[model samples]
Target: MQSIERPIIALDFPDASTTRHFLAKFGPDAHLFVKIGMELFYNAGPDIVREVRAAGHDVFLDLKLHDIPHTVEMGMRSIARLGVAMTTTHISGGSEMLQAARAGLDAGNNTRPLLLGITQLTSTSEAQMHSEQHIAGSLAADVVHRAQLAAAAGCDGVVCSALEATDILTATDKEFLRITPGIRPANAATGDQVRVVTPAQARKLHSSGIVVGRPITQSSNPVAAYTAIKQAWNLKG
Candidate 1:
């Protein structure tokens, strides 16, 4: 949390080939923090993680693991062996599950990756959460609650919306990380994201890290786009 770089790019490609090609565009010596979420990981497996790491970037394997305690613990063991820098499990899975996830990381017999719990997805709006999930609290409150639970359970950090970063940072110790997704540049469209913030805004909220997707991947010059966004984050962070 003290010295983390901003703008962890989501490598949301369809397959291993496309992911490889995308990484190639960044050229050699482009060592940024990258996210290998469900899509690419499911399609490409551990090799994608290895490929990315071999190129000198840090990998955040975003599986968002959720299941029985034993099940999740074993799953985390496997994910940990991949040597990723971070991973996610749903905070809704409860404290037992979160503790088990951390145990899994310890059992790996390798360098443990940071375990970040998912507070809420950026795609889910307040109305959707109320109507579909039957949650009554405001989004920010729920996110803070989830983050607090994660901290109590020994998690290193949590993945939350930048909107909740201010409250979460205030609520928890500065060492606890708040890795925010749903980040868009000031000029970028919201796309499918409902809870969104710009890199500068997230920085202002004291976000530990920001995740950017299409804005960089879809750009003609992804490297340039990523550089600009990272620069924006630097201004406030």
Candidate 2:
């Protein structure tokens, strides 16, 4: 919830031990908001989630669940049990699925995680959008549409690109959280992400938080890279 350290460091490593090793660089005193995506969560299981929670930091569990309402609801019962601070579902699954997912969270045994609906992945390009998904509307428009649905479903927010955050805010509540990914620091390689922006740009555009993976995780000096990004996010617009 701190304004300065908005980077939710993505723990994209293979397992929890490697995650623990990488995070150890920040020292035992540091408290970070970490992301446990499919690779690490699947390999390390819920014990990894318990370990991360026991350390006093928060976790954003990014499984991007998309399934029938009943199925998603059942899955969320288990996901909510992890007591993560945030979690994601695909808006492409529609409002029924999202509401069911939220209901399951309400039924969960632990603190409710903020539920964010994924609009479109940052790695997805316009070409891929039209060619594969057959969506002729601009990608940003599609993102906004998905975000709108998220709001109607009572979701806490949407996961979109910084490029779309301002536009999404125009249609949704200012308090509705925007969790933007694809944050590549200035001068960093874009990698697989197509709609990347710097942390400063995302903050200026009013993103609630930015999900940064390789920019910090791959750096030789991860703590320094993470610190630089936090400083950038807090800069005056």
Candidate 3:
């Protein structure tokens, strides 16, 4: 297996204190991607991104912006000012929104954040997808379609489930990163995530990275959890 030096551990916590506590436990050597979701972002704002970066960890602002072209562009421009390493816009938001976000990133003239398109969420299931969301076609087919839209819109990658990674790799070029979430190691509780895979399996399927939250964050010993996962990905090497 290929060795990954630093796996991006998404800090999907509710508050700053919880985030800080986890970071302290993990220590500075841990390669992390601090995911600032709605709750934390609403509370901490752009300052959270700055603080995470100040601590030498890359920040992935997971706002999952899904609005009109102009609004998304303006929002992306504002987010870009925060100096995050990556940001997400929903592929379901359409090509225009994605394009606008990309343009906003270009306008920043700063270290460009890797713009990823959010495909099917890890929490979604086929029944919910068809009945509730009213989306036609199979899940894998939909993911591929959205990924295509993301690529056309100049997104650097897509946030997809590991199950869809191989298909995405086949459909797109190697440079188009596939950031898969819903990663649960063997024997770990599945929790709310429906589409799950092991770290090694995800890597083998050609996923560029995997976003693991509760499995690491909710563990009794967060460091041990992270290390175990890192080892699973062969990052410990």
Candidate 4:
């Protein structure tokens, strides 16, 4: 696989038509990622997956699946058929669920999707951790522990905050991929994302990929925003 210098533009668009329109603006040579999340997946289903893949852009299916082992296994089997490049599941679902997902992907005998275990959402905060989720321990420590569990469960990678990237890298193997989301360029609005970092910072920390959504998607010129990010990252390299 070619090394991507820029952050992956995860188009968390609402529906299929919007996604199609956004993708149409970019030519075949454009280096970007199309992230299919719950909103679009719920509306358009696997057809959108085909559309994105047919356009020759890598797709990251961010379904964030969390269920029992049997159900997760079945779901992963179905997801594998779509030929997605990467997919996510919640680490909170435990080791059995993660192992089952891995087994299902292996059974498909297709190009296996890079299974990324989501440690914690960027939208979550310390207060929410204790008050809402009732999770114990400091927020950062909890995230690190969950990331370790994900790795032990045989996940290919983990979706963690850029703030925790260095810690995760230290805890896991050097080759272990860390997909960090909630990335915002300097001076950009953080939006709902609580923990954030600039693209250059994430690259310096050895993050495998960065998932960027609204900062690029909601820009006046989406392609320009993406191009700027790419340029910044390339310059860093």
Q: Report the CA-based lDDT of candidate 4 relative to the real structure.
A: 0.84
Per-residue CA lDDT of model 2 for 1-237, tens digit only, reads 323255899999998779989989998878899999999988999999889889877899999999999999988999999899999999999999999999988889998888999999999987899999999989989999999999999899989998999998899978788898999889999988999999989988878899999999999999999999988987875
lDDT of 4 by residue, 25-117 (tens): 777777467688998898988998888888888888999999999999999999998898889899999999999988888777679998989
Model 3 CA deviation exceeding 4 Å by range = 1-5, 29-31, 235-237
Residues 1-237 of candidate 1: C-alpha lDDT, one tens digit per residue? 553775899999989889888889888888889999989989888998998899899999999999999999999999888899999999999999999999999999679999999999999999998999999989899899999999999899999898888899888889999998899998788999999998889888888999999999999999999999999988852
Worst 10 residues of 1 by lDDT: 1-10
Reference-based lDDT, each prediction: 0.91, 0.90, 0.84, 0.84
lDDT of 4 at 60: 89
Residue pairs whose backbone atoms clash in candidate 4: none
Worst 10 residues of 2 by lDDT: 1-10
Residue lDDT tens for model 3, 1-237: 122234577777777887888899867866576677788888877787888888888887899999999999999898888888789999988998999999998788578888999999999998889999899889999999899899999999999998998899889888898888888889889988899999888878778887778888888997898788878876422
Whole-model alpha-carbon lDDT for candidate 3:
0.84
Per-candidate TM equals: 0.97, 0.97, 0.93, 0.94
Model 1 accuracy (lDDT, Cα): 0.91
